[model samples]
Target: MPTGRALEDARSMLLETGRRILAAEGTGGLTSRSVTDRAGVAKGVLHRHFADFDAYLAALVTDDAARIRSIEPRSAGSTVDAVTDVVEQVFTPTTRALVALVISRDEVRRRVRSPGSYGIPLLMDATAVVMDVLAAGREVGWIRRDADVAALALALIGSAHLLYAGELGAFPDHSATHEVVESILVGSL
Candidate 1:
């Protein structure tokens, strides 16, 4: 059996391979065999670290959430710019694929909704960040005072999710999506 450091390294390697596969082919192209074969690990390595495929997926999504959380805005930007940066991060290829995979698989969706779900914590944190930015924008008269911040945040999330799902990784240009979201957020400005 692999020792402590080796075990962690192995798990990380498997997860990275899984992430790449997911990004390239969506969930439909991912499996334990595929990950293990691509990762050059024993077939049972993934099972040793996770209870099952769903567990592996949950861990993967949690890893992604941590990465997303690290993309904090610098102090040099307007609230609208900051918000647009965050939205762009969500629409990145890997993130989009991961979210699309989670939504398509019933078992993975259930796992992500369970107690202590990583998705919930990430989402709550993101929503709070958006709300804070919106409030700040309102204080500065950047965002209209009557703008519904919470609804706006939800709309952003929904639009990005739908864009990823509808395109299936083939969206060559999201200028239209960006334009729409930008208009919605700063239309009155």
Candidate 2:
């Protein structure tokens, strides 16, 4: 029955609570009841905003994907550094869990995935961001002109995801992220 700002706050509260649950306990701990309890909202509030839990999850993943797309790769240093920055931004605990949630649930994956697009939701968007960085590097002579940016982007994203996704709650440090980026781009640059 909240009106105006309270109504908006209710949805934001639900989403934020869901994200915290995902970060702390992964997708296994997230449920409609859990979200409602954590957000201090009634169960019907979630249903009122979203069709079901899957739809709410889709919104969450989609919201995160948009964030990934908005990240502007750092261009101040080496191409590796730029790519590393973007990877770091994309590989946070919440994002990592969102990626897992997308992979673990078939319906949520389908709902978040764009038509005709193939790849995991958040990771795929991160790859595109890295590809843009690599393309810029190529343009500026930092990367080899003949390098296959698509493959390189994929390699970087997949390898970094493995490195970051290996441990939940604890993210890899900058050195580890740099190592992954440098190793993948060593030959291409």
Q: Candidate 2 clash total?
A: 0
lDDT of 1 by residue, 1-189 (tens): 854334558888888898898778877778899998898777778888899988998888778767776666554256656676666665666677777666667786676564764444345445656667677778888778888888887666666556555555676254755565676686634
Off by over 4 Å in 1: 1-8, 74-77, 114-128, 166-168, 172-174
Candidate 1 has an lDDT of 0.70
**Candidate No. with top lDDT:** 2
Worst 10 residues of 1 by lDDT: 117-126
- C-alpha displacement of 174 in model 2, angstroms? 0.7
Tens digits of per-residue lDDT, candidate 2, 108-154, equal 99998899999989999999998999999999999899999999999
Question: Could you give me the TM-score of model 1 versus the true structure?
Answer: 0.78
Q: Quote the lDDT for 38 in model 1.
A: 96
**CA-only RMSD, every prediction:** 3.8, 2.2
